[model samples]
Every structure is written in structure tokens, then in C-alpha cells.
Target chain A: MDALTDAELTILGLLVEHPRHGYELEHVIEERGVRNWTALGFSSIYYVLDKLAKRGLIEAIGPRTSAKSRVPFAATEAGREQCAAATREALAEPSPVRARVLVAMANSAALPDDEVAAGLAERRAALRG
Target chain B: MDALTDAELTILGLLVEHPRHGYELEHVIEERGVRNWTALGFSSIYYVLDKLAKRGLIEAIGPRTSAKSRVPFAATEAGREQCAAATREALAEPSPVRARVLVAMANSAALPDDEVAAGLAERRAALRG
Candidate 1:
């Protein structure tokens, strides 16, 4: 169903990999620079964890000082299933043509046909590469 | 700033084509099948129009009985500039990798190496094609 918002699915999906505390999740997000493409916020980590916990998609384990100074969260069976489904949805879904492209397409007259074709060719090449 | 959310940008970008009333916007949305990739709704059109107009990003033209009962809206100069900026942001901004792929990437061990390789190869082939 892709019921999870991009942030929620991202957090839960991360937990599916391993049990992680809030700080660990935050650390991984920063280390990977996931925030550049997605709007995952540092402050929203616990909020998502708590939300998932309430829905029984995730469970919080007791404090693990070894990793970080916070309780760790793990995906339950249902959570793993949810993660798989959501992940499939994410990957299978089309990467959207953003509005700027839509505007360009709508008013393509302003651009010479060759330039537009060239731009599209470059985009295709990048996707292929 | 891409301050416009996907819906807001979609709507404003539509107005960039021509002045359109509420029903026309709804009609265009349905005709385009945009709901597949984006979470646009029939109910949100006027709300978006009103919001854009309130921000002076759009101005309402006089009522046009021919199109529909609702008043038509047009983008103002500020609105056009905003559209251009926002549209640029939307296009330049990366279309994100959804959580599902991230999860699969993170937990690559569960899937057989060959399966992963095949999947990646298939994806690459699709992109190349």
C-alpha cells in the first residue's frame, strides 16, 4: 500500500536492517547524507520510532549504552513485511517528472527543439550511466 | 526554494499554461493520470488556488461562466517568478530513492548475491533501454 510516508518508511526500513537507537539512526542518516534527497529530519527520529512502535510495526528494546545512550528499536515480523512491501513500492514506482520539466514540456515552444532533444538525451544518458 | 509542495507546484505549473477555473484544473488532473505518481486530490485544487492567490503568486481573473462557475486564476509577476524558481528547484532536485530500495540495499545479505546482481543488471538494462 505504500502507507508509510517517505520518512516513516525510511526509518522503518533502516530498522529492518538492524536494531538501532535514535542516535544511531541519526548518525547513519547523516553519514549517508540521506537528508540531501529526502526530508528526513534529525528531530523526527523518535517520533517515527514511537509511531511505528504504537502500530506494532517496530518494538523498542531496553537501553544499550554500547551503541548509544538511548533505547534501541527493532522491526517486528509485521514491520519486516511492511518494510519489504514499502521497499518494493518505492523501487517499482516511477520516479516522477518534476514540475519544472512539466512546465518546460507544456511550453516547449520557448526552447528550440534541438535543445530540448539534447537535454532529454543527456537525461537518458545519465539514467543509463 | 521549491517552497511549493508537489501539489502546489503541479497546480501553479498548470496555471502557467493558461487561466483555468477549478473544474478545469480538476479535469486536467484527471486527464493526465498524475495521481499514480503524485498524491494529488480533487478536493485540494481550490485550496491550492486560494493559497497561491493569497500569497500573490496568483490572481483571480473575473468570473467566466463559460468554463465553470468558479472564478479563474492567473499567475501574477511575482507568481510567475516564483513558479520559475520553484520549477527550477523541482527539476534540479533529485527524485529520491524510496525507502524500499534503501532497505534492500542495506540488507543485501538476505538476498542471494546472484539475485541482487541480476536485479541490478536488469535495472541497468532498463535504464539503458
Candidate 2:
């Protein structure tokens, strides 16, 4: 099977901490600023949860009820195993820095020197900020 | 239009340096060890070249005749404009490190503590290497 998408791993990882409903998961993600690196949006949380359920990576352990009602999920044994493996792979792997900026930098000689330097300076500023 | 894919941007960036054919492009990528950070592979080079050409981010400037005959490609004016925009977006973007390992790290409370430490140690060793 194809490796779990980043969303899958993240959601599953959260579920590992404890059973959480969609709303709680969404809250944690936003509060923690996990959204910065993730394509996960508020709209997609339920969809991702469903996808995880269908894959048997997580299961509905119970329903969470307070102001809202939603199913709570926990990792399956297979999921825990998968998560560990995925974690190891993610941590150890040296996936390419596939940034378009890096590509531009690589070929900066083709661009005007001033533009290249200015762009890099802009990037540095952003990184610092 | 949607932003250029990483492969497209990388190939276009290479073209920006100078017009090059399939083999020369392949040689540069390998020589510089760009494969470490990129998903680019020798087999997909031609396909990526074709994709860029179709998008008009690159155009066939001429045929390069050497030990082998191949078409050489260069960035167009539109391509250059797009490259600059893409470059800025990529540079200024603080895209999340979407590694499964990170998810694992975040949810590591669910895993045994020793396993987490060992995994992290393994990763650190790999990075240091």
C-alpha cells in the first residue's frame, strides 16, 4: 500500500494520545498551529477521520457528548504498528526539499543577480520572522 | 493556474541556467546530488520535461547533437515570469515539515517511552551521519 499521507499520520498520532472527537482534534490542530505545515483544514477534519476509519487505522471507541456529539476514535493495533513504522520512516528519511524557491536558487544564475539576492533576502526575513 | 509542481519548477530552474537536453540535465542533477532532496529520478526526467514543455514553462530551443541527439529546452518570457512568482511563493512560504516522524513525535506519548527515545536516537544518528 502507498504510505500514509501526512494527514493520516498526524490524525492517527493525535488519536494515539487519547480518543478525541472531530471537534477536539480540529481544536488541537489549530491551537497548536499544526495547520502551518499541514494542508488539513477545519472542513477536512471529518473527511479525514472518515478516511482513517475506513482504512481500519482508527476505530470508533465511543461517542463524545457535551455541547456537540461526535464519535471518538483510537488507534488499532495495526495502526499503532503502522504509526511506529511511519514515524521511523519519516524521522530517518531525507526527503528532498522540494521547494520552488530552492529550485530558483539553484538556477539563480539565470536570473538577474539583484533579483536573486533580493528574493533570498526576502526569504531570510520571512524565516526570521 | 495552479502553482507549478516541484518537478516542473526544478526542471524549469535548470533550464534557466542554460538550454540543455535530456542527458545533460540528467548529468547535472546527478553530479550535484540533487536527487537527495528531490523526487526526480532518471526515468522520469523525460516525462517531467514533457510536462514542463506542455505548460509552456519551457520550450524547445533547438536540438542538441552530441554523442546522442536530443531536444534542448529553455525558459520562455512567460516561464521566467512564472518562475519568479513561484520562486517568491516558495521562498517566503513556511511550509510545515510534514514528516510522519513529526506526527509520531507529537503522539509519542501513546508509544512506549523507551521506543520513542530509541527511535529519536536512531534519527539523530542518521542526521549526524
Candidate 3:
């Protein structure tokens, strides 16, 4: 099977946690701070679900033709397997840290030292907020 | 001006460090562990330089029609200003960590405990090496 995007894997992992309606998935995502780490947007939940369903990795537990958002979706057995394998691969081969700040710091000489200091202060303020 | 992508900003920053040919950029990238955080590929360096040049952010010091790989490129004044602004923005609004392992650990119930343990062990060995 093709590798799942981070968004796909995240949503699939949530469903594997428990079958949930689209709205519930959004709630879980927000509660778990998934958006901070993954690019799964509020509007993209249904889109990701559709993709998962189309790939036969997940299926709606309720009537298929019913209102999509109201229907609870669960991971298919295949999805469980795929999610497991993807999870393992993700654990085994970690991705590198891609923080933009690292690049910015590396190139700090592009800006004045005072300006760099101010920028970092701004970041600190934002983080505190 | 449009915000530079991480790859573009990285390359532009390196050039701002000192004007260098394409081969030198590759060497510096390797030395600096740039690939760990950026998606820049070997073949895309010229493409990025073209983009920067097209936007008047950087310029080839040698003849424009000369062999692309051999020609040294430097940031224009405008390029320096833009890079400074970009650097400030990057430092100010730091992006959150997007580690896939975080997601994988959150979803570990998708796999058996032993498998997860083994996967982490494999990662540990890889890190040690």
C-alpha cells in the first residue's frame, strides 16, 4: 500500500482509537493538539475521511448515503493493518526536525544583531501569550 | 513580496553568507546538515536560483548566459532586505514541531506493544550509529 500522508495517518489513527463522526474527530484533534503538529485543518476532516474510505481503509458504520458528518466512521481491518505498519515505519525512521527558526538562526547574519534580538523577543512574547 | 519557502530561504541565506557556485552550496549544505531540516534536493538548487534571480532577489555575478553551475551568485540589495524581513518573520512566528513520531506514539494502540517497542529500539540503534 502507498504511504499515507501525515494528515491521513493522523485521522486514521484517531479512527482506530474509536469510531467517530467527523465533528468528533475535529474535537479530538483540537483536544489532542494535533493541529500544532499536523496540518489537518478543521475544514479538511471530511476530505481526509473520504480519501480513507475510498482507499478501503475505513468505512462508515452508519448508512453510507446518510449525512456524511453525522455518520460514524471506523477503521477497516485493512486500515488497522496499514495504520500499524505506518506507525511502525514512522517510529523506526524518524523524520528530521524542520523548524524554520533553525534556518532563520543559521542565517541571522543576514539581519542586524539588534533586529535578530528583537525578533527573538517577539517570539518569546508570543510564546508566553 | 511573497514569503520564501523553507528551501528557498535556506539557499538564499547560504548565498547571503558568501557568494558561491552551485557545487559549493551543495558542499555547504552537506556540511551543515541542511538536508535534515529542508527538502532541498541536489537537482533543485538551480531551479531555486532561477526563481531568486527572476524575482530580482539575487543575481549571477558572471555572465547570465554562462554555464549555470559554475557561475557565482550573490544576493542583491533587495535580496538582502527581503531575506532580513523573511528572517525576522521566521524568528518571530516560530512554527510548531511537526514530528511524526509524536503522532505515531499517540496512535500506538493501532499496533501491538511489542512492535512499537521494537520499532523504537530500531530507531535507537539507528541514532547510535
Predicted candidate 2 versus true structure: per-residue lDDT over A38-70, tens digit per residue: 557665677778878888889887744533326
lDDT of 2 by residue, B24-109 (tens): 89998899887654557576688788878888889887744533327788888888888767766666565554434555566667
C-alpha lDDT score of every prediction, in listed order: 0.67, 0.72, 0.86
Q: Write candidate 1's Cα lDDT for A1-129 as tens digits.
A: 327766677788788888988988999988977764455656668778888988899997875454433888899999988776555544544344323345444434434567557666655666677
Question: All predictions: root-mean-square deviation over Cα?
Answer: 7.5, 7.0, 6.2
- DockQ winner among the candidates? 3
lDDT value, residue A11 of candidate 3: 95
Q: What is the lDDT of residue B119 in candidate 3?
A: 93
| Model 1 chain A worst lDDT run, 10 consecutive residues | A92-101
- Give me candidate 3's TM-score against the actual structure: 0.62
Model 2 chain B scores worst on lDDT over the 10 consecutive residues at: B61-70
Predicted model with the maximum lDDT:
3
User: lDDT by residue for model 1 over B27-126, one digit each (tens)?
Assistant: 8888977654455556668778878977888888975454433778887878777766555444434345333345445545444567567666665666
Question: Candidates ranked by TM-score, best first?
Answer: 3, 2, 1
Chain A TM-score for predicted structure 3: 0.77
> lDDT, candidate 3, residue B68?
73
Colliding pairs, model 2:
A37-B96, A96-B37
Select the stronger candidate by TM-score from 2 and 3: 3
